[model samples]
Target: MGIVSVSMPEDLLEEIDDIVETHDYSGRSELFREAGRKLVQEFREPSLEDRDLVAIVSALFPYDSPAVETKMTELRHTHASAVRSNSHSCICDDQGCVETFIIEGELATVSEFVRDVEATNEDVQVEYSLFPVDSIQRPTL
Candidate 1:
């Protein structure tokens, strides 16, 4: 319908192409369109009733960004009560790092913390996305 230009590393583009071929997506545009729709639906600001939901929050940034590590650490500490688990890893292409925080609490808390982290991420030029998911932890018998 519309065209948007995005810059991605060569390897990442190749991987997209591979996924498109393997998964039978119409093309790169169709592949990205699906991803875009999913992101929008998951990341949109939640209504009051949805505030108690749990979700996984993801962030990507250059590993060497001057303030990324510190800022992320600060946010984690600031929201320690809500942030349940965290993980960090180098991206597949090695252009940057990726981090994930599995947060459990009311949606309000999760959304607020994610917004703060995302704003700071913007200052650092980091990419961020959040996906809402059911709380997956199960109780032992």
Candidate 2:
């Protein structure tokens, strides 16, 4: 086995230590190994079929980058059919911005929107979570 070095914020390290104790992990290495496996597995999963899905897409970038924001706006307009709603907020005294898009549509449409947002720019940090709409149980009338 090879050893790798990592650096993290003190607070994050503290949180990892807390988890180590709470979850009975042997150490940080063990916890990190498990987390790595989970992340890899998630990425390796096959894409879902074009089923109904709802997704919340978020993009974070510097507030001064109007180009990035403009690209996101264009993409939003291009995918307007899938976008249900959206919200934008400034963070860290306007140094950065976070834009959230609530989308509901076929899985392919939502996934395309997410891919477009992620490919906006290297500086833009994008994250999204999607859930199948059919998974929700509704009361029978």
Candidate 3:
């Protein structure tokens, strides 16, 4: 690896130091390296409009029921373009239960479908975000 020098603001440097201490990092070099990797990944990720995007739809539901699965399947079929993949998980809660889904599809359609699901299931809390692939710029070595 090539050595490089960087000048950071005093406050920012102090903040970095705090993070290092809190996380028990070996040194600022390690922290900076990880930060750089994330920055590069974010920069290299494609814009949503550039390609078909995958969306992860996470939801919390009041109980585990076949109705939830059926509804989710119907929602996926109705909005196929917005759903490339789907998955569900069960969470046990004192009041009832919670189910989560990770879905993939076109950004706009997926977002709309998520909204629809939320509207249909009043007791379910849904969250979703899109990640575009096939268009993300790969970093060069």
Q: Which number leads on TM-score?
A: 2
Candidate 3: C-alpha lDDT? 0.68
> Against the true structure, what is each candidate's TM-score?
0.54, 0.65, 0.50
**Clash count (model 3, backbone only):** 1
Model 2 over residues 73-139: C-alpha lDDT tens digits?
Answer: 8988999888889888999999999999999987668767877998888778888887878788999
* Candidate 1 residue lDDT tens string, 1-141: 778998767877999999999999989999999998886665565543464556577787776776887778888899999888888888767778877887777656866877777777553343433444444466899
Q: Write down the TM-score for model 2.
A: 0.65
Which residue pairs of candidate 1 clash?
51-107, 52-107
Off by over 4 Å in 3: 1-51, 93-104, 134-141
Candidate order by lDDT, decreasing, is: 2, 1, 3
Worst 10 residues of 2 by lDDT: 41-50
* C-alpha RMSD values across all candidates: 6.0, 5.2, 12.8
Off by over 4 Å in 1: 1-51, 123-141
Q: State the lDDT of candidate 3 residue by residue for 6-58, as single tens digits.
A: 87568778999999999999999999999989856643555664466666777
> Clash pairs of candidate 3?
84-104
In each prediction, how many residue pairs overlap at the backbone (N, C-alpha, C within less than 3 A)? 2, 0, 1
